[model samples]
Target chain A: MSDFVQSLRLWFAPGRIKDEGETPDYRFSLANERTFLAWIRTALALVGGGFAVDQFLPDLRWGVRVGLALALLAAGVLCALRAVNHWVRCERAMRRGEDLPVSRFPAVLSLAVAVVALAMVVVVVFGWAGR
Target chain B: MTEVRDPGLQPERTRLAWRRTTLSCTVVAVLAVKVAVHDDITAAGLTGLALSALVWVAFLAVAHRRIRALDAARPHPLSYRGALLAAVCTIALAVCGAAMIW
Candidate 1:
């Protein structure tokens, strides 16, 4: 019906549609959306990780239990922050017609994660050894 | 209106990665609670609830901000402060995860 068509147009109305006469910056928008979705997925994964630790390590003491909780919480917060940061940089690039800013957070965070994980491995191994 | 150059489609990929990370964190938190319950179920329950609440709030806030940025005609790049905060959080979480395993 005409009403349905009108409603659809209103709901899905392309606010920033590129005109044929205009050079569309499709790549930028596409990239931005993709990044947004990626962050969301990461956040979900972190939460899942927390649950996994809690369930499997029932014998863990306060130190382990609390540590796991904190780590997951940190991951969730970090992921969310990164997503926002990515969006801002991408948008700025679009506006200025320049390259997007590079991110160093990933590398730094990765290193931190690796180190912590390593420590955990050590602790678990030693604890088991004693047992 | 001036034509803006869209940054490379990197944000999308980054976003997806973050989502996975968060999901994993959530799982860990739940498991931590389960263990807590056995030792002191009430305390464990409280800790789990607290952690969940904190994470959920943080996630929701970030998601909301990202959506708003997308809608805006001119999106701002992620701030250095925001990035720093994220980095610190990540390191903290990694440490915590390690502690649990150890």
Candidate 2:
């Protein structure tokens, strides 16, 4: 438990990663940085989508509008957290000469997005049919 | 130690990615500001707008620094503090965006 706490405490230290292992290839590190930036962009997109749905869909039922927006916002929060965590893990693995850590987060994020898209479709279809 | 080669233009790609993400962050901040202004500005709305602006500026600084860092012959690994700050800023912007929505 203490070890975990210590590592967690060190996680945000400026030079924690450098102290672990030899600096890996600079190209690989740059690639990791790009991946992190891409994830940040994804998070931004989700947040923007949430705001658009809320502002533009004035005719949407209040409950449905807030529900959809909240879903997107929640996803954005998760994606942002995952972005930083994954970046650190990948960098540490590369420095240690180990295989890059693999995760199911991409699959999970895709599934969440698909589910949200389906919900939007349903809302649009039902609203249109009623008109 | 052998000097690293840069035939793949990795640093350039990374720098571009930072710029793109910064642009996206700016868009999100702008939208939040629009929302705050379009509606009657409540205290909460004003607070959220201010925070969104602050977070956006912080993120821009971090992104700008990283972009410049990429120009080095061999850029250092991203510091833990920098990545954490960037992530915090992005998440905070999302919260501000949500605040603007409802």
Best by DockQ: 2
Interface RMSD of 2: 1.3
Error of 1 at A12 (Å): 25
How many pairs of residues in model 2 come into backbone collision?
Answer: 0
* Candidate 1 C-alpha lDDT tens digits along A58-124: 5667677657656765666676656655654455456556676677877866786676578668767
Candidate 1 residue B1 Cα shift, in angstroms, is 21
Chain B TM-score per candidate, please: 0.51, 0.86
Compared with the true structure, what per-residue lDDT tens digits does model 2 show for residues A31-70? 8988988998999999888877887888999999988998
Model 2, position B16: C-alpha lDDT score = 88
Off by over 4 Å in 1: A1-24, B1-102
lDDT by residue for model 2 (B12-71), tens:
778888889889999888877876777687897888888988999999999888888888
Candidate that scores best on lDDT:
2
**TM-score of each prediction:** 0.50, 0.91
